[model samples]
Target: MYTLLSGLYKYMFQKDEYCILILGLDNAGKTTFLEQSKTRFHKNYKGMSLSKITTTVGLNIGTVDVGKARLMFWDLGGQEELQSLWDKYYAECHGVIYVIDSTDEERLSESKRAFEKMVTSEALDGVPILVLANKQDVETCLSIPDIKTAFSDCTSKIGRRDCLTQACSALTG
Candidate 1:
């Protein structure tokens, strides 16, 4: 009877879960964004120091509960080799957060290529995306307008899915 009651209680209070994927090129601050998000959302969560965080060779998983919904974040490694594995999780993710290093102008093209590929993937069709132009704290960083212009080619591939480009400083967030 106790076990039955416990199960019933859990079922009554279970939160809806949504899986979100964090993707970007290496050194684009994906991990920092994840750490900052966890710290901000989970009152008691003690995320690693931003300076001490290293490249994620595999992935980092974090869960945040807001109201009656639970968000599961998958922070994947962004090295060129690791990018090939991104599609493996596409089918399971409900949303995608693509980070871009605003200070790195040279890599903007490469980032655009990657973004286009991601948006065109059939596995992720119609998945909402949030493109973050990171490093906005830097005086020389690219503005949101610049990032948008650079990625304009991808607009058609993005289809009817919800998408937004916003500037952010993960270190300060």
Candidate 2:
């Protein structure tokens, strides 16, 4: 199974349809960012399973083209209930986008815990983690450096540096 999956992955990577999973707490704007991506627009994507501020219920698969490659964007459910489901799919993912709400002060701790869980989880070892410092347009948003620090601290716990965390402004104009 691993061989077949690996071959398929190589084909996709060459053909450029590698899959990526996007994760963040509720209200992190993960969906909004996917909805507004240029590839989404070009694909004329008709979104499935849109949730404004609730647990994802399950995974939602979306497609976007990134120049040479087609990106399979997997938007994971961010609610606490859905966390258990994350480990099952983490191994299949090629990359990740870890989104965080910049303005939610009370939930930062929760976000940190969730991130820490991913950092320590066995399923995500050596995966490329892209941290999206979302909601940057808000008056009170976490800075890129702060996000990187949090990610770095979590990764340090594992005594490995496989988590490549990157911060991006998903909502900034």
What's the TM for model 1? 0.96
Separately for all candidates shown, the number of backbone clashes (residues 3 or more apart, or on different chains) is 0, 1
Would you estimate the TM-scores of all the predictions?
A: 0.96, 0.76
Write down the RMSD of all candidates, one decimal each: 1.3, 5.7
- The parts of candidate 2 lying over 4 Å away from their true place are 1-14, 38-55, 149-152, 158-169
Candidate 1 residue-wise lDDT, 1-173, digit = tens: 99999999999999999999999999999999999999999898888978899999989999989999999999999988999999999999999999999999999999898888889999999899999999999999999999998998888899999999989999998
The most accurate candidate by TM-score is 1
lDDT tens per residue, model 2, 3-89: 999999887677566888888787787877776664345755544434543455687777877667778889888999888778888
* Residue 173 lDDT, candidate 1, scale 0-100: 84
**lDDT score of model 2?**
0.74
Give each model's whole-structure lDDT: 0.94, 0.74
Clash pairs (backbone) in predicted model 2: 131-166
